[model samples]
Target: MKGLFNLGPVFGYFFRKNDPNRTSNFNLRTMHFINKLSMAMFLVGFLVLLYRWFLR
Candidate 1:
């Protein structure tokens, strides 16, 4: 999983639509939505665990 961090640009490429003039399609929107949701869920779960650990 250490190599995953190095692939930031690779995953970033798919997350963004290079053509600004092009209309947003379902696939593109779905990819972005899933990316955002996963990040949010990870962040929230991390914060909860972090605070719980601190209290222990």
Candidate 2:
């Protein structure tokens, strides 16, 4: 659990700091947007699967 929470900052440090595009800030907002978008896609796919399962 501790490692899971720590992973983001560690990754962000690399992606935002080490990457060539350093103009962007390294913080939680970017991470949150990414997470939300990914979760939304997963939810949409899950709902589609459930609808298909019911049709069968």
Candidate 3:
């Protein structure tokens, strides 16, 4: 149950090295890129909300 909400995978997604054994493919790479982008946008939005809330 703890693993379900863990942030480790989120951090790992950005920091982990590529696995040499993993096959590189166009679709998979594109999907991962999109995921990273969405995560970045979410983080930025969250920070902006926090800033506005605190400064108001």
Candidate 4:
């Protein structure tokens, strides 16, 4: 988790330096990907909670 947190700036540095777009597009794509992943996780978690609620 700690390593994962630290990856953001490392990725940002490379994304900013190498990309001509200055990380704007990089940030947008990253956010979009994260948003999708979070939604997927939320759906799975909601299903699990619903199952457990009915089971109880």
Scored by TM-score, the top model is 3
The per-model lDDT (C-alpha) reads: 0.78, 0.68, 0.94, 0.69
- Per-residue lDDT value at 11 in model 2: 50
Which portions of model 2 show Cα errors greater than 4 Å?
1-26
Provide TM-scores for the models.
0.59, 0.49, 0.82, 0.52
TM-score of 2: 0.49
Model with the higher TM-score, candidate 1 or 3: 3
In model 4, what lDDT does residue 32 have?
Answer: 62
Q: State, as a TM-score between 0 and 1, how close model 1 is to the true structure.
A: 0.59
Q: Write the per-residue lDDT of candidate 1 for residues 1-56, one digit (tens) a residue.
A: 88766957745755765688878889988987898788868768988999999987
Q: Which candidate is the best by lDDT?
A: 3
> What lDDT tens digits, residue by residue, belong to model 3 across residues 13-37?
9888999999999999999999999
Candidate 2 global Cα RMSD = 9.4
The runs of at least 3 residues in candidate 4 whose Cα sits more than 4 Å from the true structure, single-residue gaps closed, are 1-24
Question: What would the per-residue lDDT of candidate 4 be over residues 2-47, giving only the tens digit for each residue?
Answer: 6765746544543453457555677887986786678668768989
- List candidate 3 stretches off by more than 4 Å: 1-6
State the lDDT at 2 in candidate 3: 81
Each candidate's clash count: 0, 0, 0, 0
Candidate 4 residue-wise lDDT at 8: 65
